[model samples]
Target: MVFSSESFLFLFLPVFMAVYYATPQRWRSYPILLGSYVFYAWWRIDFLGLLVLTTLFAYLMGQRVAAHRGSRQGRIYLTIGIGGCLLVLGVFKYLNFFVDSFAALWGTDAAGLGVHWRLILPIGISFYVFQAMSYLIDVHRGDARANARLIDFAAFIALFPQLIAGPILRYKDLEHQFEHRRHSAELFCDGMARFLVGLAKKVILADAIAPLVDLTFGASDPGFVVAWVGALAYMLQLYFDFSGYSDMAIGLGKMMGFRFGENFRFPYVSRSITEFWRRWHISLSSWLRDYLYVSLGGNRKGAARTYVNLLIVMLLGGLWHGANWTFVIWGLWHGGLLALERVTGWHQRAASYWLALPLTLMLVLLGWVMFRAEAVSDSLAIYAGMLGLNGFINDPLLFGAMSRESIALAGLAALVAAAEPKLWLIFSNAENKGPSGAVVSTRFPAASAPRAHASAALAHQNDGWTVTLATLVLGAYAVFRLTEQSFSPFLYFQF
Candidate 1:
């Protein structure tokens, strides 16, 4: 079930929270594990078994790897663990693509070979499998200890909040939290506030802009202006949609006394693709850097290998999203840009954002078209249209499909995305003094102790109330809008 859906928001969450909080501290993982299973099963009961088997297999292999650390056995177990997870991922996620591509090259298709069966990819398989593999690798590397408790480990893998589309969690980061956690009214309240804001982001912003995007991308021949508009709207739609999920997941984790890291950090404001990776889908980037790139020799072997490593990491990273050739090109686009930046020293160079921002955003936007496209030809069409090859702006079908509310909301989405960092900073740190979050900035001059302190305290109080009231209103509106709107699945779910 989607976190924003009525059943999830009004039914599952309330009941889950009630049961979870009622459970004792010592056996908290039981409820979390059970609740998580129920959540996954809600999608498909059969797939739930796949999740369970993967979790248990990883747990068992992790123990062996940990036990044999620094030995050939440890390395073998690690390889086995990773290989097993990848085998599942490959078969489920990419086997179709590979089969079709090979068949086409061989002047035939799967049907000709009597291979009519197509593997069904379990939802969130990529995320959980990656989580499981990371756990085994960490155990072997001594970065984290393998949890002896099967329930705790299982819960970590199946944690509902991020189980689907994730700010992918690592055992090393959450191992201690699984064992020991603090629960309080304050933390829970903060979680609710955070969750509400994320709900607004997804329901109000992303969903609002989706129609325009659908029109543009789905059109037979959306012209230059329409294509740009669609591209820009989609850029906003994807960020709010995926990042909204991350925010809600993290907030849900907070409610359960788990701390999930922030995934997006104003990636649009990034000066380079290098900086963009550092900010966007940060968890995955770090995972690729540490596990894949480093494992592939990183920058250690030589300059050429370093570039190759970057390209390979991004190539696989792209494939991790989907089995589409568009994704392959999307990955190569970023990977090639990364390699180029490294060679040109552009990533390391200091430049004004005015100079850097547009260049980075244009490249990112173009790559995003590839990421969003159904096929290479579709992407080329969008690119051609973007260049005015389809004639600038005049697309009657696109115009007819647009709505006023959606247009207004798209504008608002742009504004919010642009100001996202500041908005997060303000509410998230409301109690802090001044707009800049300083105790003695322009609003509170260093002066007589009592007067200054009292004024600052009053200001902080106002900010706190404002944040609460604003979030409540936004949350309520988002909820209302959600009830009125049709089912809109998150874009990242396909991954």
Candidate 2:
């Protein structure tokens, strides 16, 4: 079930938390594991078995690999384990794509080939498969020890928060947390704030912009301005939708006493493709770097090898995001840009931030069109429209149909969201200085002893007034949106 759903947020989470906290420390893992299975089972009961079976198989193979480490047999087992994971991924996710391609090339109906198997991809199959493969490979590489306990290993793979659309948690990162963890009131409160903010971003901002995107994409011969509007709205929608989900996942992890890493680092503000990768979907980038790039010789090799490694890593990275060819091209697109930077030593020569930043953002924006498109031709068509090749915006009907408030809000949200880091920094610095930093405050500087003065003034703002007001506003908006049946599934769930 989606974390944003009413049942999940109000019912499932509260019940899970209650049981989780009530369980004995030693047996805590049991309830969490069972709860996770129930969550997955809500999607498809049959798929839950696949998750359990895959976890068992991978965990067993991981132990075998760890035992045989540094030997030919160990490598063989590792390869076999990885291959098995990929084989399952391919069969469930890529079978249709492959069948269609084969049929087209051979002029034979793929359905008549007798090899066609209609498979319903288990929810989170792609994510957990990658996570599972990473575990086996890390064990083979000696980066992490294989867990002897089957339950512990299974929990690591099936952890519900990151199971569906993940920051793609690494085995090594979470290995210790599986058995040992620290919980605190402060972390729990902070997680609530983060989760609320993420919920607002998705339900409020992303949902607000989605219809514009849907309309633009759904049109026949979309006008140039309409296409640009659609593409821009889509870009905003994607960031809020995916990043919002990531935020919720991270917050849930924190509340559960698991410290998952932040996934999005304000990637919209990145100044280069390389910088963008470092900021966006950071965990996945690091995963491919450590597991794939390093295994493929990494930067320890010369420039030639590094370039080849980057391309291969990116190509697979794109495929990992989805089974579609567009994703493959999206990966190659970034790979090519990275290669260009390497060859020309452009990354070494820092251009003016003014020039470099927008250039990077534009490149990224264009790339998103490709990533969002259903097919390569649609991407090209949309891109052409974006460049004003299609006379979309001149149509008065589109403009007149859109609410001025929505248009204004869309523009404002994009600008404010892009400036998120600066905004957070501003509030943070102000916060450290005490009540003096707050405008229209009741207390003046040095009205009393420093700590006491700060405490009294801080009490005014922190008395749940601001939080209650914010919550009420957001809750109202969420209810209105929910009533309208305007919920949009998170973009990254497919990954």
lDDT score, candidate 2? 0.79
Looking at candidate 2, the ten consecutive residues that score lowest on lDDT are: 428-437
Tens-place lDDT digits, model 2, residues 1-495:
887787787789999999998887667778778989999998889888889988988999999998999999999999899999989899888887788778768877777676556666676888899899999988988898885477777888889988999979888888788778988886676566567667777887887887787776666556787788788888888888888888788778878888788788888877778888988888889989988898899988899999998999999989887778899999999998988888987666635457878888788878888888888888887877777777657567875666665667679778867788875444323323211223333555665788887787677557445554565577567656655764467778776
Q: Model 2: residues >4 Å from true position, as ranges?
A: 107-117, 392-406, 426-476
TM-score of predicted model 2?
Answer: 0.90
Question: What's the distance in Å from true for residue 282, model 2?
Answer: 0.7
Best by lDDT: 1
Give the best candidate by TM-score.
Answer: 1
Per residue, candidate 1 scores C-alpha lDDT tens digits across 1-495 of 999899999899999999998898889999999999999899899999889889888988898898889999889988898899988899899999998898889899999767898988889988999899888878887898885588888889999999999989998888789889999887788788878888999999999999989888887677987889889989999999999998899889979998888788889888899999998999899999998999899999999999999999999999999999999999999999999999999998835547898899899999999999898888888888899889986677677678988889999988987888788778767634332224533355567598778987787788889998999999999999999999998888899
